[model samples]
Target: MGESPHAVTSLPTARQAGCPFDPPAELIEARRHGPISGFTHPGGKPGWLITGYDLVRSVLADPRFSSRKELMNVVDFELPPAPPGEFLLMDEPQHGRYRKPLVGKFTARRMRLLTERIEQITTDCLDAMEQAGPPADLVTAFAKPVPAIIICELLGVPYEERGSFQAQIETFLNGETGEEELMAAYTATQQYLAHLVAAKRAHPTDDLLSDLTNSDLTAEELQGIALILLSAGFDTTANTLALGTFALLQNPTQLAALRADPALTDRAVEELLRYLSVAKSFMRTALEDVELGGRTIEAGTTVVLSYNTANRDPERFTDPHVLDLRRQDGGHLAFGHGVHQCLGQQLARIELRVALPALLNRFPTLRLAVPAAEVDLRPEIADIHGVKSLPVAWDA
Candidate 1:
């Protein structure tokens, strides 16, 4: 559904300095200029990118707009037909039905089960990190592993094979360095999950995969949902962990606030997610004729909603660029708003809340191992944006 004649006003290109997926100084500067605007994607595709806080929120909440993943680009990746029964691409009634049963499992109460496991994982990673000496790349040692291990445990993944899974996910997210590698990584992940799910069917465990297998749903449906869980659950949380740490390091006042009152860790995580906008942008195809922010959007046009831009809209947020954890009204669209608001947010919050406070309390002297600006943040590689390497120094 992409041949719509909907005319959106032309705005500047969405290209940031380092990567297309990141929010550069330009986009932030533009957000201050206006709310809803246009931006040419790097490939010269005229994308109706929603930047205004209220406008972005309206698009996500509106049923007239669609979030199907296929209409991204006709010339893009030629993968196999998406497997059936996977509900991620479904809109409206179908999307609602698929998500209804699964939402309960992600509640704060259910997520609390993983708190101890998260701590154990964080401690193990840091313990090994201490053995690595000072000026360590925390991305490899702590930031990366903490959430990976926690997610693995939450989904009942075999922790022993964590290295292989981590490698696959990394290749997929490393947008610039690995295209061929990304496809291979995705295929390997499917095979790995296929084998893992089959085993779970035979011997049911108390994990999400096992639960999905044992559910009354069809086999195909189980596979589709399981694949979504693996892709979204792993990549989003891992990005947030690294990006959130980098954000706190850059803003010591927020870091110290959490260090003082660890109970506010949950709120601080929300603030971090709001401030960093780690997921970047999501694509949508127009399902029918609809106008947004004075632009005539016809049926079947592709539009991109930039969470990074919307999160910092000054109209809805005051001093939008700065990282303010004490903000009471800062309900940023770091997670897309409306029906597609990240289903896994509760799980992500628990993981981040547990890990960040633990790290700060444990490593009191923690600081960046390199200059802040030198820390590379290339977001254009994948659907998610974050740091590849986060270096830090602190005495054990």
Candidate 2:
């Protein structure tokens, strides 16, 4: 009922050594103390960190917590409004306007229709990995390319342009690139998307972007939407594939269960989603004073919703830290919740369902090539969490 004794002074960057899948120790400790803890943003603004499953889900669904970029009061300076069609950072009518048109396009049934193509994509990546032999960096050979190609095809990006597009995306999302390099990659991507939007307008094709060309959305808006889809479509799933593979190898019992019963693939994917939670945390600003977890979140204060910890909350899931492929609990926030929940989640699910099993089945002896500690992980600063390179090897 009273304020938590713990106060998070800054965002944690490093995960505990050898515990790559766990949220930062400080965050887990904060959750242990209580669901909501006092937090001081890096920029000196006071805030709260919501680490409980129920509280995080509540904040996500509550309209009183604003998602608008400009409304976030954690930083000292005013933030620019979200670019057009980036509905993740917007709210209400505007978010609905951009999202409603695409809702039907990404439903579970619609994404399932793409299962055949996704299988082929997964198969192709595995074939390439086989030809190249073991000790391959799965991040490049399999994880990154599988989703990269699928998203490219979905957006109607030509095969010739995909390599460059993927490189630019890597630069911006890698989380370790210099500021200048990051901005350059961002600008190049925007320019390319702008050009792609124009091409789609002039010569409509059988792709999601081209389909949107018929809508009332402007080219700029279309470009913004394309950027969102491309980035979200590729990065999150790629990380899940690589990181999930790593988790399975470490938990042979779970891996063997999945391998023995192919029907368990869907459940395994859900368990991995809850375990890894690579998307990590998200920020929301309070539109007004709101009571949460026995504390008041003052108006204009920003709060960090810790998804990783919430997904692993003890009160929510039994043996929360263990990786249990057969675990029956569902409704993880891996893809998030509420109005701004991931648009491409079903597509992501399809890709994971097809790709992960295909990779495991293709290489029955698959395991890490390097020491588990040597596996390079993306820094916490990245919007998405994942591996930089998953070095893997299997018996030849």
Candidate 3:
């Protein structure tokens, strides 16, 4: 293996001031230097940071690089294994065990079958926005509720509780909440899911979680699985819709292309997913020594895969920084790659393909209600990056 590159000690938190959609300049620079670089986790344990597109994708597909949470050696203290069904943090056959049963649930065909319902939900949101008049905070009015409602239905969560459940999720993910608030929200969600799981066991319904009850999975495992699905399903797509709209409004030419040709919708959705890549970085640990990008990842070492940078890597994309709806390039890591790739990706695609155009078509004059700079953004430390509230307006 080649000599390791010097470590970039800190993970970047600041995006270039005006470029909210871009990865931090430091990360882009790191990718330019080399695919793999040395790093020190905030906890002071040494690790690798993989920023290049090819390298990130390669590492994600490598079984020698484990995803087990307990195996992550980033900190000195021992960390517990991921909860029972949180398989994203586990390696196979555990990961495969959890993921395989649910594959049919999120198949492209299954998600596509929900297109009409997604249309109705999108329409309902636009109707509410129209009724409420102009200058609405799109985050609350449209983005958050659309996906929140869908995930709740999928999980068999009671309709009436969705509002509070959504709030709790936001509190945990928005990245600015105090520790007490964060813990409160997390505890509430866990308690709610526990009760929800028992309820599903007692009385199965037509929903995905209800269906999973037939599996040998224990209630605790079901709760963990629900938590993963709920968090990933709602948060990622919600931010993509909100932030994608922001990007569209900023680039009117691209927006016009999407609006003018419904045929562009699918391609546009992929581009937006790639461009936003909001669920930024993911960490993996080497189960044994592995050579990647000409450097050795020692056994039990953690590596941070920078998704946003990978999506924007100039080597893999032409004019990587620009968002073009008609651009033909695909295979972005927005939903990730390999076995751990997002299961809900097809569902997310349907949401965007249905929601964005419906939104744009409903309000032709849509534009930001506040100055671009004044739009509140989630803190850089947030697990997901996006606007806190997108204040948007259209002709009354």
Candidate 4:
């Protein structure tokens, strides 16, 4: 409860130059000082930043920390509550209400069922990349399309509508667009989802969205749920694919190890998830005065759980900075922890498991077309961290 001297005045934004995969150096330094550091949010409210693995995971699983959007006290102005069916920002029963129905749909077994289809998608993408010859932007040719198509099919979106749908979602999440463009993209997505949900109600199909239409959820709720699924399902995995490939090309030893042994794919994926931590930080507000990492989190205090730094905490993983494909210590918070953990994590794992190795096998000589430093990375302000365009080449 006593005042600590190591309060970070502001959240760190810039990652160390040329080290796209690591957390900002300031964060790593913060962790070295202690697991928890006092922090001041950009909006001028005081809070805490949790950088230790144990502390970050504990906060995620703790009921005392509320995820409700409106409860976040870091900002001066009161925030609106999350929309219906957008469970990520809601707590307890409301969160469970929206999440429970989807749990059965995204279970490991259910997701694995889509493996063959995902494999086909990955293969078809690689085929296009090959046909186009060398010097292809992997983001467009392979990474983006693979997840985009899979998610569209899962939501039963008509094949003809996917191209525009994908573009709109990209604009919504890319984080670089102006406020006007961002809202326009979001509005377009919402409108489209409304139409899609109505179509599903009148004529249900075998897809996840259609199945959800049969539930007690209304058209508006279904639209919200579909929006969450479509955005989360597409963006995170897409970034991981593009950024993971860039990471591998940078770490030839790890990539070569995976190439040498096919079984390493699973471990490699886990390690990559840990190393990249592309989704980055999440926020939680203290419901009551609580002690965390020897500090008192006052009631209504907001804390930023730095996932990337936590995943790299040396106490949690030995040599945490190194990307070891064969890493066995696998409890990383990339997909997150607790009740609100990512719903599509299993699907993501399957996509990465199949796509990365397959891409490697298909093009044994694949490497970045530009120099490592020349690869364009998404801005730190972006919700997802990844390459804007991963220009890659392979022997034709």
Mark the regions of model 1 whose C-alpha exceeds 4 Å error after superposition. Answer: 1-22, 41-44, 72-81
TM-score of 4: 0.98
C-alpha lDDT values of all predictions: 0.72, 0.92, 0.91, 0.91
Query: TM-score of the candidate numbered 3?
Result: 0.98
Best by lDDT: 2
**Poorly placed runs, candidate 2 (over 4 Å):** 1-3
Candidate 1's displacement at residue 62, Å, is 0.8
Models 1 onward score TM values of 0.88, 0.98, 0.98, 0.98
Give candidates' CA RMSD values in order. 3.7, 1.1, 1.2, 1.0
lDDT tens digits, residue span 196-219, model 4: 998999999999999998789988
Q: lDDT tens string, model 2, 1-396?
A: 246668888986579999999999999999999999999888988899999999999999999999999998877999999999888889898999999999999999999999999999889888989999988999899999999999999999999999998999889988899999999999999999999999999999999999999999999899889998988999999999999999999999889999999999999999999999999999999998999988988889999999999999999999999999888788899989999999999999999999999999999999999999999888888878888898999898
True-vs-predicted CA distance for residue 106, candidate 3, Å: 0.7
The Cα error of candidate 2 at residue 130, in Å, is: 0.5
